[model samples]
Target: MKKSLNELKELAKICRGDIIKMTTVAKSGHPGGSMSSIDMYLSVFNLANIDPKNPYDYKRDRVVISHGHTSPGVYSALSRLGFLNPDEVIAGFRHSGSIFEGHITRGIPGIEWTTGNLGQGLSAGVGMALASKITGNNYHVFVLHSDGEAPKGQIAEARRTAKKENLNNLTVLVDYNDIQISGRARDVLYVDLFKEYESAGWNIIEVDGHDFEQLFNAIEEAKNYKLGPTVIIAKTIIGKGVSFMENRHEYHGAPLNDVEADKALKELGVENDIEKYKEMRKTLPLLRKKLEFDDYVITADAGTPITYTKEDKVDNRGAFGNAIADLAKINKGKIVAVDCDLKPSVKLGKFEKVSPETYVQIGIQEHNAATIAGAMSVCGVIPFFADFGVFGLDETFNQQRLNDINHTNLKTAVTHCGIDIGEDGKTHHEINYIGIVRSFFDTKLIVPADPNQTDRAVRYAASTLGNVVIAMGRSKIPVILDENGNPYFGETYEFEYGKMDILRKGEKLTILTHGSVAYKAVKVADKLKKEGINISVINVSAPLEFDASRISEYIDNSHIIIYEDHNKYNGLMVEFSKSVVENRLSPLSVENLGIDNYSPSGNNENLFKIFGLDEDSLYEKIKEKINK
Candidate 1:
């Protein structure tokens, strides 16, 4: 139910006081921007289809605040609207033990997405809007952002996407306060907010942000809009309501002093309850419980895992594409494919063909694509973002990091990893994927050893929850085989995450590898076997995680070598060293051969040979080490 105009005005005034007290009590936060956006926040949550009683209603319209620095304003608005206790937020605003964090978090009763990185909220909003399209839901997505963060290229990219997808159910409210952390937003960087979004074909509306009636009317119009997405350029004053703090950039991030707070309280006619909150703040603990994210259970048929024979010359990327297409067929409404214009290169062509409606082609916007896929993953649909490794991982690491924090169930199949995309040179090579994924606490990295493994891994990620990055190479290699020459990673084989697969066991030495080099490790093992030398070849597919107990047996009391088309210092070597030290496993000798430096343009075979990662190089190195 919409609050009466008179009630909203009274609440807005109180909310202004709430914002000031919360930030001042916290003694650190973006108070000026919070005051500027308080009225907008009040109007939206009050008028939108949200029930504080049933806050987790999946049908409730999502409210995403992009400029998370103004978290004080958001908490104030939410509390005043009865979603939370207004006094608790006022006292515990930035206190570490409080749910009211320094930045706006998602698990809060009314908040939808956690956003502080300027340009990502709109993309997330777009993702939620796209969710409505596929699921036959009519709920709208409202993204409240700041004009200071308007110049971000990702917003422009998302703007184009909103128009391209014809998302009429989306509305963006840009808090156009001229002042920013530097000075005026224009002086820092001129982003013609209306023109940029208008150029992208979004319907534009200019409004006095503090006016509840106008804000409500524009939002209502936006909801009823059928042409495309709408953007409300809300003209607001920095540090609004309080007379002294108006239009000042100094308070953009700072709270008011005691003297200033006293004077401000007098001007607003609101009680200065600082002493009461101070007592409460003193008693609060420093550590808060971890925030819980929305549970997103993805249900999908993994289709059937395919087994590539020794005669089948196929790249892991091709196998991934086939699996995605197959999953699309079996899981009709439950799956979506997010692509970044590298459909052919990333081998998403087959998936696109099989499920055109489920395939979302966001052109050349990796950051936006990452966030979009992350948001969509949580909102009923399982989104697979298929892209090249350089663009997917190296280019958009921060976006993926946010996805990790959001605990999104995103399956990112990144092809063209390592020097395997050899002719493209060092720029295209994603040698540090293991290092990148290692930084994440939740995301899993599976460097599938061959097409057969890739097929099963892709299906595994699709059926599972949480973030998964299936890293693959560009080159087509032969399928791996067992001692009897039967196909390894066969149809009967299930892709058990964190469990290492031992294909050929030997006692002379142990070779650890994954992705494109597992088959090469077998070649090295086979070569030594021909010379009557025994060794073990193990496939460590899930680099970020592995069954340490299983790997302890292979590396214990034996010479070990780690061969890969990855960075030597940060890849499996790091994980192996950690596990070995922790488990007290003893290795007679340890050798790691990987890309120490970027290789020049050449074929993958030549690049491998140049870097001493080729089968012959590994065979020779192991032979010398065993003799020693």
Candidate 2:
């Protein structure tokens, strides 16, 4: 139900008071921007088709606050509109124990996206808008950003994507307060926001942000515009309701002192209740009860797994392409693949051919594409972001981190990882992916050893929930074969995540490897066995997880060989050593055969030999260890 203009005016005053009280009580927050953005937040929350009781309703509109430092404004607006309790918000703002942190968080009622880092929210909105078209949910996405973030290149990238996708279901409300922490926005970095939006083919509207009638009318106009996404440039005053702090850059990030807050409250005719909230905050629990939001339900049908034989001579990327194409055919609208103009290289061309409508081509914009894929995953669509490891994991690392923070069900398939990428050199080789993903608590990483394993991993990732990364290299390696000369990851082999695949069992020593190096390890073991040195070889696809029990049986005098095409400091070798110590296993002299430094661009085979990771080098190293 839309509130009347007079009713909205009265509510805005209360919300303004709430914003002031919360910030003043917290003593650490951006009050100026919050005050400036409060009225617009109130107007949108009241007018949007959102139910406070059923805040996570699938049919409801999504609201993203890009400038999350203005959390006081968002919490106040949501509280005033019945989405949260005003008392809790005022008492818990910026409190360590509360869900109401300094920045806005998702899974909180009425907060669609957790956006403290600026300029990414628009891309998130574009993703949701694109998901609306894919899932036919038809829910509109409204992103409220600030003028301080107008100069970001990701915003420009998002604008182009929105226009290219013709996302008429998206609208952006920019709080053009023209004030940043340093000084005036124009002086900080002049960005002609209106002209930029106009150039991006967006319908533009200028309105007074504090005026209820003008804001309401502009929003209605934007909702009705059919050409493309709309941007409402709302002119706002910093410190809107308080005269003492109005238009002062000092108040942008600094909360007013107690005396100044009291004077400002008196000026706005709002009671100064900071002391009461301050006392209540001290009694607040360190950890609040978990807030309930709708859980992500996987709806896509993971098609039958594909098996590749030794004669297939296909790369892991090719197997991924086939698996995703198969998934797209079965899942149809439920699955989408996001590509960063590397369709041919990343092997998403097959997926594009199978389901062209579901394949998104975001040309050369990995940052924007990464964020879009993450946001799309949560909006009832299983999005797989396919790109080279350098772009997908290394270049867009922060975006991937944000996706992890959002707990998105994004399957990131990064091909051409490690030195197997060959001539692309150090710049293209992604050797630190294991370390990068280890930082995330919820995200899972899978390094498939062969085409057969890659196929199963892709299928497994599709059927699974949460964020999963299936990393592969750029070589046509042979399929991993069992002792009986059949495919190791064959028809009957299910892809159990975090389980090590012991390809060859022996007693002299154990060889642990994954990805492009797994087949080489098995061959090395065979050669050593021929020379009267029987050694076990294990492929650890999930390097992030350390299960000491899986390898306890193969610990031959604690003499293990850790060889991989990854950085020695953060790869499986480090993981194995940590697990060994943590699990209280007997210490043994281990030979770490991993990349110690970057190599020159050449054939992958030659590169391996240069780095002393080839089959012969590994065989000799193992023999020397056994002889010792």
Candidate 3:
């Protein structure tokens, strides 16, 4: 039920009081911005097509709190509107024992995308808005941001994309309070926000943020506007309610003291019952039940796996393209392919042809693409962000990290990984992908050995939940063959994550390898076996995790060589060494035969030989180790 203008005005005052009390009790929060943004929050939440009872509905309107530091205002407005308990939000506001974190979290009631890192929220909102168009859902997306984060490049990228897509269901309510951590937002960054939005083709509406009626009307106009996305630049005063705190930059992030809070609450005409909540804060549990996000279980039909044989010489990127395009055909609009101006190189042209509506091309905007894909993943879309590994993983690491924090189900199919892209040189070679991906706790990395394995890995990543990176090289690789000259990752092979595949059996020394060099390891093992020096060759597709039992027999008290086209310091060698010690498997000697430093532009074979990772070089290294 929508509240009357008079009723909303009264509620805002109470919410203002709640904001002051909560932040003062917590002693750390951005109360000033919260106070400034409170009236707008109250209006939007009331006007939006959202229900406190059915907040988890996929079709519900998404309200992304981009400036998540204003949680006091968000929680207070939500509590007053029946989305949360007032007392819990006040007492548990930034306590280690409570879910009410300093930054707004997504699992909380009424929260959509959890955004604290400035500049990415708009991109996330754009993704959610695009999902509605692709799925034919009428739900709208609203992102509440601030002028303080206006100068960020990702925000500009998001604005252009929104306008380019003509997202009529998306609205951004920017809190133009003009104050930030240091001082005035204009003095800090000097971004002409209105001109920026105008140039980007957004429908702009300037309004008084403190006026409930004006905010409600602006939102109503945005909801009905059909040309493109709308941006309501709300002019507001920092610490709006209290006269002493008004326009003061010091109050931007720092909370008021207890005495000041009491005074502020008294001015707002709300009761000062802070003593009771302060006591309640102490009694809250250190650990509450974690919020479960199992609402979006993937139901798309992952089509039949395509197997490549010895006759088919293809790059892993080609295999990825075939698998993802097949998935798009089978799932239709449910599988979205996001490209960062690398559709041709990343092999997403087929996917675009099959599902044009779902293929989002965010040209040269990897940061925005990464966050946008992450947001779309939660909004009933299986988004696959395809790009070169350097751009997708290296340049957009921070965005990907934020995606991981949001626990988003994003599948990133990155090609041109490692030096296999060769002549592209050091800048293009993503030698640290394994290290970068390993840093994300919830993300899994799959480095497929050959074209056949790449196809299976892509499908597996699409079907799974959480973040997964399917890293592959640009060069075409031969199909890995078994003893009978048959494709090892053949027709019947079901890709089980974390399981090691032993391509060749031996006894002298064990060689562990993945992706760019897995086939080389097998060749070396076969050649050594021919010379009466048997050694085991294992393919570790999922480098981040593995089942110790699968490879324990080969490494127990035996010499081990970790060979790969990755940085030796933090690649598979580091992970394998930890497993050996943790699983109590004692290896006689472990050597790392991987890229120790960057190589110059040249053929991948020459680069491999230089880095001691080519077939012959690996064979010679194993021989030397065995001789010792």
lDDT of 3 by residue, 1-628 (tens): 6788999999999998998888888888999999999998999999998888888887889899899999999999899988899999999999988889999998887898777899889999999999889888789999999999999999999999999999999999999989999999888889888999999999999999999888988999999999999999999999998988999999998888888888888888889988988899989888877877535536467679898878898999999999999998888789999998888899988988898888898999999999999999988889999999999999999999999999999999899999899999999999999999988989999999999999889888888888999999999889999988999999889899998898999886888889968888887777877888888989999988965566788988789888889999999988887877788988889889888887899999999988988888887788788998
How far is 234's C-alpha from truth in model 1 (Å)? 0.7
Clashing residue pairs found in predicted model 2? none
- How well is each residue in 1-628 modelled by candidate 2, as lDDT tens digits? 5678898788877777887788878888888999999889988988888999888877788898899999999999898788888999999999887889899999999998888989899999999899988888888889999999999999999999999999999999999999998999999999998899999999999999999889999888888888899999999999998887889999899987788888877887887888889999999988887666895446567778998887899999999999999999998788899999888888988888889899999999999999999999888889999999989998998899999889889999999999999999988999988998998988999999999999999999999998999999999999889988999999999998999998998885888889999999998887777878788888899998868767887863657888899998889877887888787776366878878887789898899999889988987888788777
Q: Write the per-residue lDDT of candidate 1 for residues 144-217, one digit (tens) a residue.
A: 99999988988888899999999999999999999899999999999898889878999999999999889999
Model 1, runs deviating above 4 Å: 293-296
Backbone clash numbers for all candidates listed: 2, 0, 0
List candidate 2 stretches off by more than 4 Å.
296-299
Q: Provide the lowest-lDDT 10-residue window in model 2.
A: 291-300
lDDT of 1: 0.89
TM-score of 1: 0.98
Off by over 4 Å in 3: 297-299
TM-score, model 3 to reference: 0.99
Estimated TM-score for each candidate: 0.98, 0.98, 0.99
Model 2 vs. true fold: TM: 0.98
Worst 10 residues of 3 by lDDT: 291-300
In the predicted model 1, the residue pairs found to clash are 498-547, 506-535
